[model samples]
Target: MQIWIFSYLHFLWALNKSMIIEWTHKRKNSHYISMIR
Candidate 1:
């Protein structure tokens, strides 16, 4: 859960730079699960 929150925060930061790199593996998986929850 913490990891998902962390990445989401990072996603906000990446918007300033450009965009997040394609999330694969646990990164993307956790994001989707968190969203559903």
Candidate 2:
């Protein structure tokens, strides 16, 4: 039970981090494109 809880928590943490990374990357790309325009 402890192991299961830890695994689930870690998965959630990793997913959140990946989402933040993707969001920031897309935001940077958009900023760059806007600058080009």
Candidate 3:
């Protein structure tokens, strides 16, 4: 039971980390496009 909970938490943390990276990348791309104009 403890191992299962630990794995679940780890999975959630990895998912959140990837999401944050993706969000930041999108934001940067948009900002770069606006600056070009």
lDDT of 3 by residue, 1-37 (tens): 9999999999999999999999999999999999999
Strongest candidate by TM-score: 3
lDDT of each: 0.77, 1.00, 1.00
Model 1 residue 27 CA deviation in Å: 35
What is candidate 2's lDDT per residue for 1-37, written digit by digit as tens?
9999999999999999999999999999999999999
Error of 2 at 2 (Å): 0.8
Q: Which ten residues in a row have the lowest lDDT in candidate 1?
A: 16-25
Q: Supply every candidate's count of residue pairs whose N, Cα or C atoms clash at under 3 angstroms.
A: 0, 0, 0
Pairs of residues clashing in candidate 3: none
Error of 1 at 23 (Å): 26
Question: Which should have the higher TM-score, number 2 or number 3?
Answer: 3
- Off-target runs (Cα >4 Å) in candidate 3 are none
